[model samples]
Target chain A: MTPIDKNSNMPPESEAAAELLDTQLDAALQSYTVDAPSDLLAARILKMAKATPQQKQTFQDIETGNIRQENVLWREKRYGFGIAALLLISLTFAFGTLNFAPSDTESDTAEIWLEAAADLGMSDIYDWVEGQTNSMDDTR
Target chain B: MIYKADPDQDVLTGLMSGDERALKELMRRHLDRIHRTAMRILGDAALAEDVAQTVFLKTWEMAPNWVSGKARLLSWMLRVTTRQCLDILKKKAPIYTDDMPDISDTSDLADKKMIKDDSAKMVRKAIERLPNRQKIALTLSYYENVSQRDGAEIMDITVGAYEALLVRARKTLKNTLIRDAEISTERPKDDRKLAL
Candidate 1:
């Protein structure tokens, strides 16, 4: 494309005004520098990178209090929720049609889970699912 | 320091390979320029620092995946910073509070310092009044001296769009300053006499 100013002649006043702003903006740009952070934030980032191993740099660990990372976390949570919903819908359909089990309401399902746990000597697993306060840490 | 040839070409490589000194050197070289672009465009020192932090953090995260020779590292960083600033502006509803940084009268002779400070403040305010796209274009092209093509790429617009943005930005600034009686109508002053 031909440059915008090639053919048309701007009024001298408008032309001069543009020139003045060019000078003014140039000066402002020249004068402004961001040294607000006494230490360059890069230093802090490098330190954090050093502290965290690469594989261990999970979203929650790195995203705390960071606006940009929090945005990514927001999208990730939405995606995770979508997948979980799809999986739940698939499982519900499968269990109903495949006769994996007879239809049961919430309390009936809970009872069945408890009975199965007892049969497997996994009653403690039910307690674990319920977030028990216990000495499992000592065992570990 | 251990010798590594071609800091610019290999810094991203080293960064991905977990080289601390490479990160340090990259910071030393480009941090000021990148930070300055954010500060100038956003016109908020506090927000600019946050933007800078996010930009570098992003670079660190993405360094391993950066295709060498595809784009210059500094351009990529500035592009990120620009986008961050734009995002903040979108959230803030474009209310550019007139909280110009306080001027230090101790810089030069009293009269000269005051004029320079006044001019700088006026220019900043004029810039703040611009619409967001104009602000981005002016900051990237005029202020940061990024080439128009690179500025367009950073803005995610074509080069023609970038030039049009600059033209409109310049026009708006000209009209606003003239109408406000902030810009001098006198003959353009000598370079040494210019405040900024």
Candidate 2:
């Protein structure tokens, strides 16, 4: 028997061989027969079907609802994250505006202390130092 | 306009309205074919039964939305069967050669019935060894006698592709059987003597 080409067109002799092979193959394939399923098969399927709920809505409705549910859940998650970020930004700005400088009352108290020191002959010490310098110059 | 009434339309309507009798009617119509197809593809009775049950349950669930003329109910069920069988085949490697009868015993004592059974088993084993797509194409075309167009639809492939798969499956099966025959012919004489 001529070998049948896998890709090219078969010649006449090869065609005959291929035909015979096909017939033999078909017969062999038909030899393996299966018996009908048990009676319990239908009963089991019906029992399971009874427990299941049939589709009530249109096919389009069910498909749309599935997609819409996913989108809605995603949108809700996005909104949640957005609100959290806004709160964080607001708190950061509130703390950044807080003043850390010394108060006006502290500044005024410091000025008063300096004036009191001046009132307590802080200038007389300068004049005594000037007179000491004049005596030193006359001694020279 | 002549509306050719679909025979299953009434039962389908009843099913959608929650009638168990309609479901029974459907089983009476298609259960055997569905179960047989599953059994051939899966080659395991229990798994075949599971596939059949799942296909029916799916039919019931889809009954409400089943458009009357979109596709034949049998085609839809068979499509489901094929998909389910493929899924099972993916998860577990099918044991095709296990428990197979020894075909090499060509002794004078071998009866005709034994020879026939062995031949059938050989064919079945060869088929099981085919790739899943080829196995399915052969099963649908040869066993179920499904038309190429319907088979294409069931397999979700073009008709040309389905035909090509069938051709490849037959060629592979033929080559395998021929190789097996040559091997059996070349078996050592000692082995035959031992069988005797």
RMSD values for the candidates in order, in angstroms, are: 18.3, 9.9
DockQ of 1: 0.12
CA lDDT, every model vs. true structure: 0.66, 0.76
Please give the lDDT score at residue A111 for candidate 2. Answer: 84
- Summarize candidate 1's per-residue lDDT along B9-90 as a digit string, tens digits: 7687777676778778887887777777777777888788778777876777666556566667777788888889889987
Candidate 1 on A1-140: residue-level lDDT in tens? Answer: 11112112345568774565566545544553335455847667688767754332434545564335547878899899999999999999988887866556667787888788699999777678656445655566
- Measured by TM-score, how close is model 2 to the native structure? 0.66
Over the full model, what C-alpha lDDT does candidate 2 score relative to the true structure?
0.76
Error of 2 at B14 (Å): 1.9
Question: With candidate 2 superimposed using the best TM-score fit, by how many Å does residue B178's alpha carbon deviate from the native?
Answer: 2.1
TM-scores of chain A across the candidates, in order, are 0.25, 0.40
Measured as a fraction from 0 to 1, the native contacts recovered by model 2 come to: 0.75
Where in model 1 is the C-alpha error above 4 Å? A1-37, A40-42, A52-140, B1-7, B95-117, B182-196
Which candidate achieves the best TM-score against the true structure?
2
Q: Pull out the clashing pairs in model 1.
A: none
> lDDT, candidate 1, residue B34?
76
